[model samples]
Target: MEFWLRVTRSQITKEIRAGRTDTWAAFALVVRLFREAMRKRAAGDERLWGDLLRYAQDVVDRTPGA
Candidate 1:
C-alpha cells in the first residue's frame, strides 16, 4: 500500500486499516478543521468553537477508535 499523509476521510481510513496512520496526526487535523470552521463563523460572540470540536469528535468517534 501507498503512504499518504493528507487528511481526508478516505485516506485516513485507508491508512488506519493499513496500519500507517498516526493517531496524533489524525486528531491534530480534526482540531485544525474545528479551528477553521470556528474561524469562519465569527459572528456575535458565542460558543461555537466548542460546538465545532464536539461535532468533529462525534465524527471521529463514529469511526473505529485507535
Candidate 2:
C-alpha cells in the first residue's frame, strides 16, 4: 500500500513536469508564430494575421500576477 502510494506520487510529479515542458514549448511556438506574422506584415505581405494575442490574453487572464 505504501509502495503504491509512493509510485502514484512519483507518477504525478512526472506528469506535472511533462505538462510544464509542454506549456513552455507551446508558449515559445506562439511567440515565434506572432513574430513571423508581424515580420511578414512589415514586409508588405498583407495576408499575415492572427497569433499570440489570444494566447497571451489567456496567459494574462490565468496568471496570479495579472
Candidate 3:
C-alpha cells in the first residue's frame, strides 16, 4: 500500500510537471493510475473502480472544455 501510494504521488508529480492540470488531464491521470493498479491486481474491486471511473467521467462531461 505504501509503495502504491508512493508510485501514485510520483505519477502525479510527473503529470503536474508536464502541465497536466485541467479536468480532462485529471480524469486521464485517474484512469491511467486505475489501469496500472488493476493490471497489478491492486485496485480493489472491479465494481468500486467502475463506479469511481464513471463518477469521474460524469464530472468531466459536466465540466466545460474537459
Candidate 4:
C-alpha cells in the first residue's frame, strides 16, 4: 500500500508537470491513471478503490464529450 501510494504520487507529479500547459493532456493523463488504478484494484488491492473509482467517474461526468 505504501509503495503504491508513493508510485501514484510520483506519477501524478510527473503527469502534472508534463501537462502543465495543456488541459486536455492533463485529462488524458488522469484517465490513463484511473484505468491503471482500476486494473490494480481489480487485481487485488481494495483499499481506497471505491474513492478512486468515484473520482474517475466524476472526472468523466464533468469532462466535455467524454
lDDT of each: 0.68, 0.68, 0.73, 0.74
Q: What value does the lDDT take at residue 11 in candidate 1?
A: 62
TM-scores for all candidates: the values are 0.36, 0.45, 0.36, 0.40
Model 3, which residues run further than 4 Å from truth?
A: 23-66
Error of 1 at 31 (Å): 0.1
Q: What is the lDDT of residue 49 in candidate 4?
A: 73
Q: Write the per-residue lDDT of candidate 2 for residues 1-66, one digit (tens) a residue.
A: 899668756765676688755654665675698789888878887465544556667888899763
Model 3 lDDT on a 0 to 1 scale:
0.73
- Candidate 4, residues 1-66, lDDT tens digits: the string is 899668766776776789654655775786687787778788997655788868868998999784
Ten-residue stretch with the least lDDT total in model 3: 36-45
- Give stretches of model 2 more than 4 Å off: 1-18, 50-66
Model 1 RMSD, rounded to 1 decimal? 9.3
Shift in Å, residue 5, candidate 1: 24
Instruction: Name the candidate that leads on lDDT.
Output: 4
Task: Count steric clashes of candidate 4.
Answer: 0
